[model samples]
Target: MRRVPGRPFEPEEYVLETNTILFRVFSTGGMVPRTVTDFNPGKGDRTRFAFFGDPTVPVLYAAESEEAAVCESILHDVPSGPGAVLYESFADRVCAPLAPTRDLSLVSLMGDGLFKLGTQARYVTGTMASQYTRTVRWAEAVHEAGFDGLVWMSNRRNTDRAFVFFGDRVEAGDLVALPGTGRIFAAGAGFDWLADYLTSLKIEILIP
Candidate 1:
């Protein structure tokens, strides 16, 4: 597999139906609203699919399931061990359920989709954080190819699919919040449920 796949190839497309509920974990303290479908402006840390040169081309990530959302976001950096996650990590974080108002056409990076692009899944999905600079170039290429977003198997949860939408292509009104479904991760039923879920994975959250 090449470090970076050639650009302008015919990418396999995946259509995300409007009925599919996507899960996203976000910080309540962040500039974007909890229930809004705003993209990250690339003002902070680098992400796997963020634009390398143009910070103006924003991105928003979501997962197919709640477990995938938590694993990909909140539990992303936590190591696989007892008490590996800190309680402070949960502060101000919340998960919102969202769905597209209309069908979204996205470039598929899984299965035969990889073959269409002349690359393997590992090169695109299994890359480490240090390789984001190289990985992001693929996103730029995909965006330039006129795709709305990219969809692939989640690195943290392979059984689930992860999605990244380009802000320049995907409008804010394209996605809508599911009414009364947002959950705050730090306290109450949200905390209790998450604690139980983490316990099943042999990860304990130490409260300071």
Candidate 2:
């Protein structure tokens, strides 16, 4: 690979351009914004977010972030939880990495986006869990299945969202890549920014 700049640049990146049809479903799935105002990030955060694009390979769309995104609920930082903090911490196989709660919290803080690893990512850096194996698991269904991406309808500023692109629908539209199978697409009714994008409902990676 060419020398990776401080910021890895993807020359073949694209978006769905129009995925409103799918996002309408995401909104109905209760994944929509709970509070429109909460969607907006501080002015400082918004500015920074715009400048820094997502880095996941085949990076899809970016989700709007919230100051109080209730991450603690999903990523418990306490001493113990129902599962391992970093699933990788306990993983012997590479396809089923687990990240209980604490691990999620730790990794989430390591970068700007979630579960993202670009071809340009530094040597031995920015890897969350290498447990996912596409050859043995239906990972494409999740990453490359049909879903393109999920964009948060946020009005926030700097605090931006993270994403994991699915690649099943490569022919879908304008989207960011998520390593192998992740894609980003437009799903909502008025997300004009994503005129050619297609968000995914579910993903499944094929096990070869």
Candidate 3:
């Protein structure tokens, strides 16, 4: 995956292909094309689409049936993207944050409620301990937001940081919500684990 560098490091174009079809997926501030025809590879091709709410996170798409509309672009990068089977609709009622909530506590919210991170948590177990670094400004932002320091899973306490960056403007304990989509952008391994914890409470998280 290519990372476009700037304030927000976004993944470069992800090209998806089928026997007779081609799809290019891009994440522009979380704004995904609304329909298949909205961004058809060509004038009269059958293309379908879907995306997540996170503006910076990379998204995925798949086609049920398609045929290659011969073009110069479709000939390359045909095997790089993920292969997904099309569904009439891919709504995740269990995890979709269809409604917003006032509660911002990471642990107190229930069943798809949005919340903020209370502190800068880290996943220090397995190989994750040595992976993912917080950019200098981002690290400063995490602390300035009054976040409690790093969090680790199990008994791992090592604070080795990698060059991987997280959302910069967002602070610790800040509510992670994707505007207009009724969902939250849960990034990093710690929040990923938090989503699992929420699942234990019968809450499904819409992590983009």
Candidate 4:
């Protein structure tokens, strides 16, 4: 599917999605109109409706009920790779920051929660390793420079670094929250703020 603007990466902690969606296609037989519809996540994952010109006598809809009469459906791409489908959502979670096309530094925070650097080389997310990036900037300062980052599993963006960017200002011990998993990744004026912000929101799915 094409990436939509408003779509959040995915929740870091726990991600869930339907295994498959229901689709319907109606034939008009030169009398009515044939309709096609796909199951979406909005207005609930399941639904039913009746519209005129439904030449097939039934309407098109997407739902999860066992009683649902479907014309056709495709299964969700369950990842067979090491860590693909293992997570709940789509691989786009890891795909985003790793998406080398982006402009930012993505460090790892590992399950142990420590600051670690990466070899992104800019403009390509082809990862050299599967380590989790941390948000805490220990030595580098983020106040003087603009910062951008997100949390894993959570789809929130942390712009809290604005306070540091505008002024040569910073408190001795100030803290900020990340998007996906609301965890305190790091503290420092040297590192970019967005890095911590993004490391927090982690959602991913593998496409095969």
Candidate 5:
């Protein structure tokens, strides 16, 4: 694995089609807009691709698939084996499908993209939470280079891709929520679906 390059290099670009649907698992009735890109500079927890120290350069994250979105968000901190994921974790969370109103030019963080960046997958995409500070520098570099966003293999579910779009770069009308496809993971069809999905992974949802 090559060391993370200090100087910014030209990143490979990947174009996301307007037809590709992305899933974002987020909380409802929160301070931020429910289905819109989160422009709030994150306060407490550090995130993988969030631009650090720049309120103007906010970010929004999503996954290529619903299962990948759930794994990356709701189940992100749940430990493997015998660990119980609490029902409260899903209480206000919903997965919404959204699509770009136009094609997005994103920095590709997979395949030959990593090779060009002088780093490995684990360094950029698979690091633990504690290393987010280091990882975010890469994002800052990407933002500095004026890319629309980034695309990487999900650390939680590597088979699927995860995305982060720069709020400043993605215009207000860039993404639109699809109707009738949103699911609240706490109850009804959402809960039923989550339960079955968890059963397959041998994880239980504990209600308190």
Candidate 6:
């Protein structure tokens, strides 16, 4: 919380850091103040209880953000056609909680010199009027399900891609394997960075 020498500290400034991640708190403009637990402002009306290691707590309230517009398309912004704009007004908001997409522990779990090939499918929502309605109804379900954010895939038109509503709980290796689920393949924008990391390990991506 120490301010840099000679630099005026910003009142809205906040930061969270863990062993593997770091990001700044842009603003609480979209925070559900009533829903937030243990909110205590250090100063005038500003919450001082920031810097959370747990991804469940939102770090920023994304208002009219492109990320929000894209992820919340199921709410009614996508079908209008490509380049469809959403969140045009202040009524729309997306809470950006921090979450880990990649689990680096896999490096050790694989053992020395051992390599495995796996497919990673881009996560997308199912295409169906009923599905979109379900999505719209589930707008608040994310908070209920304890997800950081609704992670979207690359394709916007094809909503049929695999979409994980509760993606905040997702880890890097969740797709490749899990305790009881066995092997499966799914990718998300949050894990886009892993593509490069996986390639460094000699893993290849195949499109069918």
Best by TM-score: 1
- Candidate 4 lDDT by residue in tens digits, 110-208: 221121222121211111112112211211222112222211211111111100011112111121111232111122321223233222323122324
lDDT of 2 by residue, 155-178 (tens): 222244333333222323232222
Best-fitting candidate, scored by lDDT? 1
How do all models score by TM-score?
A: 0.93, 0.21, 0.15, 0.14, 0.92, 0.24
lDDT of 1 by residue, 1-208 (tens): 6668684568899999986899998877755554447677776787888855444798899999989999888877776566568888877888888899889999999999998888887787777788888888788888888888999998878999999998888897898888875777789988888888999999888889
Lowest lDDT sum, 10 consecutive residues, model 2, at 94-103
lDDT score for residue 10 of model 4: 22
Candidate 6 lDDT by residue in tens digits, 1-208: 1111112211111111122221111222444342211122222321111222234332222112333323333223334322322222212322233323343121100112011111111111333433332233222333343443332222332332112222233333332211221111134432353234334434333444
**Ten consecutive residues with minimal summed lDDT in candidate 4?**
159-168
Q: Please list the residue runs of candidate 1 whose C-alpha ends up more than 4 Å from where it truly belongs after superposition.
A: 30-36, 53-55, 81-83
Q: What C-alpha lDDT values do all the predictions have?
A: 0.84, 0.23, 0.22, 0.19, 0.82, 0.26
The order of the candidates by TM-score, greatest first, is 1, 5, 6, 2, 3, 4
Cα lDDT of model 5 by residue, 1-208, tens digit: 6545456478889999996888999877566646644544564477877657545477788999999999898888777556678898889988888889999999889999898877888999888888787888888888888888899998878899999988888888798888776888878999999888888878898998
Model 6 residue runs over 4 Å out of place are: 1-78, 82-97, 101-124, 132-208
Candidate 6 lDDT score relative to the true structure: 0.26
Off by over 4 Å in 3: 1-94, 102-131, 135-140, 146-208
Report the Cα lDDT for residue 198, model 2. 11
Model 4, position 176: C-alpha lDDT score? 19
Selected candidate, larger lDDT, 2 vs 6: 6
As for candidate 3, its clashing pairs are 20-67, 20-68, 29-55, 30-55, 117-173, 121-151, 122-151, 132-162, 133-162
